[model samples]
Target: MNDVYVVGVGMTPFGKHPDRSAADLAAEAILGALDDAGLRTVDIEAAWVGHVYQGMAMGQRGLGAAGISGLPITNVENACSSGSTAIYEAATALKAGAYDIVLALGVELLSTKFRGALAPDESDIEAQIGLTMPSVYAMRARRHMEQYGTTPRMLAAIASKNKFNASLNPLAQFKKPVTVDEVMAGRLIAEPLHLHECAPVSDGAAAVILVSGKKLSQLGSSRAIRLVASALRSGKLEVGLPDMTVEDLTWRTAEAAYQQAGLGPDDVQMAEVHDCFSIAEATRIEGLKLYPLGEYPARVERGEAGLGGRLPVNMSGGLLGKGHPLGATGVAQVIEIVKQLRGEAKDRQVPGAKVGLAHCRGGKARGVEGTACTVNILTI
Candidate 1:
């Protein structure tokens, strides 16, 4: 099998775009990535698109808008992990020698899709019980507090750090730095989680160009970021009473990714984790083994996870401040890491960074910890 590298990455500014169609957003992202790769429409061998609520032939519509057609375009919808899953499929094809150059695009125009809080599919018993995304995280926050003495202020600090990081990212949804006090005083979505602590409903798109080792050699581009590992796993069924604060699914997926990359969490210099909620950041870092269990909250308080700290997490403001555009989120996380590894993340750059990790967990279903979880390791 051959290695795969991300030769190009592009994304639209994440925010409410009531007038933009999903196809428009996707087409823009695709063109940007093609330009970034220094490639043209005719260079792509195949394509895969990740989307939900975009209706049938979403990939075809988006790619057609970009003037790309007649190529195999697989559509993926693994909830929020859809984007990363598309990347995984593209890499898989490259490794299998099915195609040398592939495009993985993720797009979602969520502003026009739904209003108010997002919930699990109605088929899910949990959704029937009034379980919303925020409420689920709120319950997890409560569990973390009970297990580790975490305070609401500590949770707010996570939001503050991410939002501050967002201020440096021109494309982020919320570019202004928010204060912990402001976060704490924000409207309550669920107990222990304020509106500021939750990821906003966003509309955006991101795309990446994946190439085989042979393709990379032919291109001879120094801008490529090696995709050292890509691991995806579904949440296991909960049995008996288990610790809700711990993320077994994330650990399993991350472990697989580390082994595949031949690098552990300690080797990662920066990370873009799934911080759909303030507390999710802490739990994800701990689960990824980037920090000791029950210690990330204090680590944030001491700025250990800040831009210039020991390990920078969510330098793109993450989902909390960067905005979570569902299908687009996972791909956007990889884009941020690629930028950071390439020394192009100007204001939020983690200096001397060599390795980065991107984690994305999405969706909620009945009797599962999560719907899908993905871990991708990238290196310069």
Candidate 2:
């Protein structure tokens, strides 16, 4: 099997873009990736696009706007994990030797589609029972506090950290860091979770170009990063009540990624995990084994996850600070990790990053831990 490499990555500024369409955002991101890779659209043999609420044939429409046609284009939707799922598919094709060069793009114009806290599909019993996205994380936050002695202030600190990181990220939604007091002052969305602790509704796009090892050698692309592993998993059905503080889905997906990469969590120097909520970041890092269970909050307070700390996490601002454009999010996470690995992240760069992880978990169902989870490992 041929190893896949990430040759180029691009993402649009994540925030409200009421003037733009999803297809337009995708075209911009795709062209940017092409330019970054020093390749033309003609070099791409196939494409995959991920989006939700963008209607049918989104990939074709987006690619058409970019003046790219007459190629195999697939549209994927797996809730918020849609973008990462597209990346997974592209890597699979590269490894299968079916495509030498492929494009994976994720875009969402969420500003026009919805507002306020997003809920699961209405058909789901959970949604019917008034289980909203914020409420889910809030419940988990409470559980973490109960089980780990984490404080409301600790969770507020998490938001403050990510917002600070966002201030350094030019493409992030929130460019100004908020204090823990400011975060706590925001209107309460759920018990113990204020509005600032949640991810904002955003519109954006992200794209990545993947190539086979042979193609990498042919191009002599010194900037390319090895895509060591791309693992994806759907949440398992729960047979009994499970612990809410921990993420079994994240652990399972990371385990698969670790096995494929032949490296443990300790090998990773930095990460961009799904930080859709302040508490979500802690559960995810612990699930990835980057920090001990019930200890990430303390680690955060110690500056261990800061940019210059032992292992920086969410340097691109993550979902909370960077904005959550649903389908565009997972791909954006990879874009950040790739930039960091290449030492291209200007203000938020980790000094000596070599290995990075990008994890994305999305969706909620009645009896499952999560809807879908994806873990991708990249190395220089």
Candidate 3:
């Protein structure tokens, strides 16, 4: 395997756009990324796409719409981590010396018809148990409260801060900021989680162009956000131990990435982690060793993880604030880091950002914490 660097990035405003199909939105993002790279779609050697809800061959339609040439294309799906899978695939391909320039993308246009998530399958144990993502996250929230005495007010504060941050992002889905009191009084969907505490179903797309170390010069305007390490792990029943879980998978993945990059949490200048829910953000921080178990909230309350904190996190508002377009989130993370490194993130830019770490996790796969996770560390 060889070095891979992200040289370009793009994204659409995350929100309801019932007028556009997933293909159209995805193509828009691809065009933006190509323009950002000062290249044409024809320059792409291969591509990987991730989406959880789109119908058959929709990825092909996106590529064709973007005027991309006949290249090997792989469509991927890994629930919420779908977008990250696209990034990992592109990096792996480039590292193998198979392709010098590759495109990694994720796009989704969620509407009210997102019933697939609600559909039940008799043979599926969780579906049989009626355990949707909201319910499962709610359970986790409950456990956090029962064990650590985490409060709803704290969760509300997290939402409020992220919302304020997202207000500066022109492409963010929600611009209206909220008060902690408002969040506390907001309509309750699941106990301990007001409407503001949960992520909204959003519609958007994000894309990025990656190149091998040798092909970095192919890019015109943008410089390299060198992809230092890419690591992915899936949970297996055999790995189950008392402390073993999907959260543990994040730690393992980050460890591998840390070893590969020769960096640690202390070295990371910024991060855009998977924050599908409030508790998830806290737990993941601990799992990644940014803090200890059950210490994230205290760290968070001290403003240690905010925009000007020791290690600023989720400058893109994360999924909770910017809206989770599921498939697009993973690649969007890379896109945001590219902007931060390039000094192009006008408002959300992290001062003196040079090293960044990011991740995306999704669904209940064969794991204790459920689903799979993909992590990457980058430097410029």
Query: Could you say which candidate leads in lDDT?
Result: 1
lDDT of 2 by residue, 1-380 (tens): 89999998888899999999888999999999999999998899999898887999999988888889999999999988999999999999999999999999999998887978889889998889799999999999999999999998888888899999999999999989999899988999988999889999999999999999999999999889999999999999888778898799999999999999999988999999999999999999999999888999887877888878988889888998999998899999999988998999998889888999999989998888899999999999
| Each prediction's TM-score versus the true structure | 0.99, 0.99, 0.94
Global local distance difference test of model 1: 0.93
Off by over 4 Å in 2: none
Range of the 10 consecutive residues with the lowest summed lDDT in candidate 1 = 109-118
For candidate 3, the 10 contiguous residues with the lowest summed lDDT are: 113-122
The clash count of every prediction, one per candidate, is: 0, 0, 2
Per-residue CA lDDT of model 1 for 33-127, tens digit only, reads 99999999989999989987788989999999999999999999999899999998898899889999999999999887788788999888888
| Candidate 1 deviant stretches above 4 angstroms | none
Number of colliding residue pairs in model 1: 0
lDDT of each: 0.93, 0.92, 0.80
TM-score of 1: 0.99
